[model samples]
Structure formats: structure tokens, C-alpha cells
Target: MMRGEGQELLNDVGCICEENGALDLLQVVVGKGDVYDGIWTELQKDHASLQAEIGYLLQNQQKFDVNLNVRHFGKVTKSTIQADGTLMDAAEKIFRGTIDFVRGSADSVGAETEQVLLLGDDVVNKTIPVILCAEENVQGSHGAAIGELDEETLFYFGARGMDRTQAENTIARAKLEAKIQKIGDADIEQKVKTQLAEVLDRDNR
Candidate 1:
């Protein structure tokens, strides 16, 4: 987890998986600041696998950039998920990801997905997803979603006595909550939820 308060942050991460091994990672960031996050992962042997998920919520005049690189050295599986939300026109974000299937990485499978929610028009969002394959039997896929809330959805929340901002906050919270609920430790999960609620309340204020 990472948080920033009007300062710049840079997070660089690397991971390697050996033969028949697996790796899983989750990263979350929230606040009003500038952030640049980069991750590089390699599957070094047959049957190795890697899974990584990243979530971020930025409000006010914040900027975020994320980059991910995955290399399949052998037959392996790699998957990545990126979920991001921006609540103000001054926020900006960019996501860049790449998956490379090397020559010996036959039968390797890789997938990447990114979802972004925009609450205002002046927010800047850029996404670049790439898959490069040198093996004949490799499979790679990527997809992304970037948009604002629909009027119908807003109306549904309004009917429940929630204003437009409240509805948008609820939707954004759901994205992070989905991941938080997956924590294996109940105590940690609850603690995170509480902290998240406090943060959301502060932001709303």
C-alpha cells in the first residue's frame, strides 16, 4: 500500500518466478499527489506463473503513471489487473503494460486488464497495452475500460436518496472494496475497510 500527500512518489517493483513456482501480489494507492509506479516480472522456468493486481484512487490535483512489463522465459502464465479512479478534473493518469513471450516460452498464456472511472471531463487518461510473442504456441490478451458514470446509473442512486457525488463515491469505493474483501486475514480486512471509510469521508469533506 502507498499514500501521498501533495508530494511525488515513485514505486519500482520486480519479481521472478522459478520452475513450477507461483507469485501473487496486490498493491493499492490512494490520495492527492503525484505517483509513478513501475513493475517488472519474469517467469524463468516451465510451469511458472504470476498474478498481480493494482488499484488506485486519486482526487483533486493528482497525477499517476503506471507501467508493467512481463517476460515469459518458459511455459508460464502471467496475469495483471489495474483498477483506477479519478474524481476531479485536475487529475491525470497513464497506464502502460507489456507482455513478452520469448522464443522458448511455448504454450505460455498471458492476460492484462485495466479499468478506469472518470468523474469529470477535464481528467486526462491514457492507456497503452502491448503483447509481443516470439513463440508459436503462446497466447496473450489485453483489454481496458475508461469512462464516466451514466445518467441512468446516477438516477438509480438518486432514487435511494444519494446525491450525484455520493453515488459516484459509492461506485469508486466498490472497486477497491472488491479487492479488500479478498484479504485472507479477517482482522486486516476489517482494518483496511475502516481506514478506507475514513479516507473516503475525508475526501468527501
Candidate 2:
């Protein structure tokens, strides 16, 4: 299902399993011009049922940059493209994050992209899934890859300025803001922003 502008949209992007089964899902989020800035969210629930308990979770996140005509300007843009998939009977779960960018103006060319992936429970037992791809085309093409923060990075931050939890909160806030900017309503965007801020604060614990 899909939700349009004006009406706030929330959807469960994933499904659970009662018995063994296969599931496939994909999602695409685009950031457009002035009238298109708004927040969008997809929640996936993997609850176990009676008789037998099985569950799986998958996620994907990607960010792309667009090159518009130089004459077209004054617009706010943001997007959170997420995918979730799970296989029942086998009890397999997957979580992936992909961020792709087509950054920069055509005149002064530059290329950069980034991706991140997250998996849980059954997913960790499986192989590390693919996170990004660059179609053979040159115009500033590169993706800065980062996995979830490592313990060492957290420790380093703790020793310097922030506690481990604080470091995590900082990163989460940055990402949440990027997603909200895509939410297309000023009032709604602000509401989601404040709600996200509260979530980040709680995570700092």
C-alpha cells in the first residue's frame, strides 16, 4: 500500500511467518522538489505464532542524489528507502541498508554515494549480504561504506567527548533528520522531528 501527501502515512513493510515460508519485498523512496518534502516510515513486525514459532527480518536503505537543471532551485529534499524480508520455515532473517548518491552539479562535477546494512538474530548466522552497486557510468561515482558502529569506535568516542551511548545517539539523530526532510509537510515534518528527537534521547541510555 502507498500513502500520499497531506495525509500522514505509516506502513508495515514486512510480514511474519506461522510456518516455514518464503517472502520477498522491495521499496524505493525518491526525494523531489519544494512541495515534496515530508516524512515516510515502514515498520515490519515479525511476531511468532502458536503451534510453531518462526520469524525473519530484512531491511534495506538507500540514498540517491539527483542532478536537476541549474535553473530549477529552492526545494527541500529527503528520502528513506527501506526494504524488509523474512523466510519462515527456515527461520531466516535479513536486514540491509543501501545508500546511493548522484551528487553534484553537472558543470562542476563530483561523485559520492554511501550505504549501511543492519541484521538481527537469525540473520547474523548467514552470510553478509551485498549492500551497494555502481552502474558503469562516470560522473563522480563512489560510495562511502560504513557498517553499524563498532565497539572500538564507540570506545574512542567515549574516551574523548561522548559516552558510548551518546555516540550512538548522535549518529541516530543525524540519520533520522535526513529521513524527515523527505517528509512533505512543514507541520508534520516538525512533529516527526520532535518525536525522533525523543527516540534518540532514549537510545543514548
Candidate 3:
């Protein structure tokens, strides 16, 4: 939730040790101006697992830079990080995701992936995913997907009688739907949805 007229900087560091436990996190961000967000999650004990899902939308000439670090330190531990984003107007976003498998974390598994949808001509999107494994017995992987709408998809929207702009709005909103549905609180979810609709609708004008 980083939105304002002036630039914003946020650093959130979290370290937890889990034994036969799990942790899950979801982040949905809609912002203005320039923002730098850092999320750090580390330490997992034997049989522990961690999962993180992030969705961000930026418009106008705003810039959003986010960094996430996940570390595993226990045997048989598991972790996953997934991020999806959309950039409109001259906005830009930089996503840095890192997953580390430390020694003694044998048989650990770690994976990270990022996807970005681009809108407008001058928008910029960059993703840097790093995997560090100090244990040879662990498994780690990383990848990214970045692009615009394809003709086939566009046709699908048109068949449903949705104009280009309307179809795009639907697409943009869809990026965060997964995490939004997990909010559990009906009132808060509706408020967030209202805010997103207002922001996206305003940007369309």
C-alpha cells in the first residue's frame, strides 16, 4: 500500500524459524509517485515451508521498485515466490527476487517466478531473479515472463463485445484477483476493490 504524491521508501524485514511449520504471504499494491519496497523473509526449520504471492499495479509516470529475499536454512524445507505486475503510461517497475539455499538445508526446494504485463508505449519492466545454493543436495530455480497482449487474446475479448480499453481494464484487474480473494474479510476486500477500480478507471481517462 504505497501511494502518495511524494516518493516513498519502505523496508520490511521478517525472519522466522519454523519446525514442521509453514508461512504464506500475499501482497497487492496499487500506488502513485515513486516507491521503493523491500520484503525480506528468511529462516525455515526442518519440514517448514514458505510461500509468497505479490501483485502490483502502477500508472502515470510513477516508478515502483520491489526487492524480495527468501532464505531456507533447514533440511527438507521448501519455499516459493511468485510475482505478477502491470505497468501503464510511462510507469516503470523493477522486481528483484532472490532465493537462497544454505548449507545443512539438505533436500530443500526453492523456486521463484515473475510475470509482468506492459501497457502504454514508454513503460518499462525489469525482473532479476537470483538463486543461491550452498548445498549440492538442494533444488532451486527461477524464471520470468514479460510482454503485452497478443492478437489471439485480443480477439477473445472482442468476441465478448469488449472494447480494447474495457478488455484491458479487465485484464489489469485480473492480475491481482487471486491474492484479493484470499483476503478473507469481505468488507476489506470490497474496499480494496473499490480503490483499485477507481484508480484504474481514473488512469483510463
Candidate 4:
């Protein structure tokens, strides 16, 4: 949690998967209030795999900077990184994801993807996805989807008698539902959901 105004928040993570080892990781970050967070994973032996997922929500001029790095140093290694984020009302966000395949890491596979939702004209979003390889037999890919809601999708809600404000609120809630479920504690999740509702309601006015 952020301590106070003008303070910074940062979290760094590192993991090593041994031979025949596997790891599945999930990360969630919410800022309202730099939140710099980084994760690094290394696969050092045969048949090692890593799966990483990250979710973030920022609003009200908040700022968040995050990065993920996955390194493959063994044969038949695999890694996948997925990131989902939402930014609203002058908020700023930057995300960088890299997958490195070292020599001798033949047959290794890696993919990274990012999805972002923009809800304000003043919001700023930047994403950099990189794949570095030193192995000819390895496979790697990266993709990003970032933008506001499409008109057709928004129309789907208007047809149901919802106004433009209502439509945006509904769409944002639907997207946030998935991340809300990622919250482990029931009480905390509910609290955040309630806070989100209040925020949206204020905007609706």
C-alpha cells in the first residue's frame, strides 16, 4: 500500500524454476491514490515452464509503471505472460514485458499479451512488449490491445435503455469483475467493489 502523497511504491519479484519444475503466478495492483513493480522469472533446466498474469486499475491522476521479464536457459522451456489494465481520468500507466531465450534453450516457447481499457480523454497508456532470442529452435510472440470501448459494444448497452454514462459504467464494471474475483479476501473485494461503484456513480452525475 502507498504510504502517503508524493511517496512511491515498488515491488520486485524473482523466481527460478529448476529442471522439470513449473510455476504459475498471479499479480494484482490497484492505485487510486510511481507504483513501480517488476517480476523476473528464470527457467534454468529441462522442461521448466512459467505462467504469469498481472492485473491493474488506476484512476484519478494516479501513475503506475510495471515490467515483467522471463528468461529461458534450458531445453524445452516455456513461458507465458498476460496483463490486463484499466486507466481513467488523467491517470498514467506504462508496461514493459520481455521474454529472453538463451542459447541451448531449443524447443522453448514464449508468448506475451497485454489488454488495456481507456475511459478518459486525458488518460495516458504506453506498452512495450519485447522478445529476445538466441536459440533458433525457440518460438516467441508478443501482442497488445489498447483503446476505448468500441461504439458497437457501447450500443449494445444503450439498446437496453442505458444512457451513455450508464453504458460506460456497465462496461467498466464488467471488465473489473474479473479482476475483482482475483482478490483473495471476500471482505476486501466487496469493499473495493463498493468503492468502485461510488466512484462510477459520482461520474454519472
What do the candidate models score in CA lDDT, each in turn?
0.78, 0.31, 0.82, 0.81
> Candidate 2 residues 82-131, lDDT tens each?
32222111222223232222222112222223343232222222222222
Instruction: List runs of model 3 lying over 4 Å from the truth.
Output: 7-11, 203-205
lDDT string for model 3 (124-147, tens) is 888888889899999999888889
Full-model lDDT, candidate 3: 0.82
Clashing pairs in 3: none
Candidate 1 residue spans exceeding 4 A from truth = 82-89, 185-195, 202-205
What are the TM-scores, per candidate, against the unseen true structure? 0.89, 0.34, 0.91, 0.87
TM-score of 1: 0.89
| Per-residue lDDT over 1-205 for candidate 4, one digit per residue giving the tens place of the 0 to 100 score | 3223456787898999999998888766553445888888999999999988877667777788888889999999999888887787788998888899999999999999889989889999999888998999999999988989888977888888888767776767766668778768898788767766765664532
Give me the displacement of residue 160 in model 3, in angstroms.
3.1
Error of 2 at 75 (Å): 29
Predicted candidate 4: what Cα RMSD to the true structure?
Answer: 2.6
- Candidate 4 TM-score, true structure as reference: 0.87
- What lDDT, from 0 to 1, does candidate 2 have? 0.31
lDDT of 1: 0.78
Ranking by lDDT: 3, 4, 1, 2
